[model samples]
Target: MSIPSKEFTGRHMLMTTVAFFTVVIGVNVTMALYASSSWSGLVVENTYVASQEFNRKAAEAKTMAASGVVGKLSFLHGAIHYDIRNRDGSPAAVDEVAANFKRPVGDHEDFHVAFAKVSEGRFEATHRLTSGDWIVEIVSRRDGKVVMHEADRIDTGGSGQ
Candidate 1:
């Protein structure tokens, strides 16, 4: 028996379309991941807080939110005073930071953040944070790219500082 010419044409067309869609979807996904990784994206990081392990934090936050464990951060210049309020008039919050900075770095705990503390207009991360090259992405409720600062890495290992 011989295969019908129409059957061959229809199968070929369907396969071609499916292949096209697959490639398109793959590229879209890759681009999305890169953009999302950036500081500014769909889910903005207004105060330099990157939700690296969002799912994990979400689960934890959900549980803690009920317990009234609101996240807060503090920016410090000398690891003593709140530098966040020094320059900017706005008060900032430290959401979370690396608990164990001395330990090996992981995909998530890249750095820490303190969120939504409004002493003035500026915001801070966390006190005792694992100091070292932090990306201070400061956005504003008014607009984007308000200002950003990068702080030198410090030791939280309690090395007699």
Candidate 2:
């Protein structure tokens, strides 16, 4: 005697469709939660306030760029180093140097490092950043006024060196 097989029916079809949609919807919800929790997507807290200062900040940036002050940054031995020069290739005279390190898409690893003068036009900060991509903002100040402001993107290789 042969065992009989059950025939496929509309109830089976309906259950299959429901199961497929449930899995799809569940995966989409999980992905959405992960994306939302990962990054806040906030560039500036107040757009209106930022807009009000846009022109002045732009003018200052233009002036800073026109001054031809250049900064070279490097990571060595788990330390941050910055070298600054003027248009004439001589050391730029600034009283203080500070750096803001930020992740490309998140703020969890963001930090501020105050650099000390190691030598003429040279500043050093003993901060070991994790090996990854970073956005660096270097600000040099003279007599309580910002003299040079530079932004650069850098990758700390696998060794974080």
TM-score per model over all chains: 0.27, 0.71
Q: In model 2, where do residues sit more than 4 Å from their true spots?
A: 1-42
Candidate 2 structure quality by residue, lDDT tens digits, 1-161: 99999989999999999999999999999999998888644477799999999999899889988999999998888888899999999998989999999987779899999999998799999987998878888999989999898888888867776
Alpha carbon RMSD to native, model 2: 6.7
Model 2 lowest lDDT segment of ten? 36-45
lDDT for position 113 in model 2? 97
Error of 1 at 43 (Å): 11
> For model 1, what is the C-alpha lDDT against the true structure?
0.41
Give the winner by lDDT.
2
Instruction: Go through the candidates in order and give each one's C-alpha lDDT.
Output: 0.41, 0.89
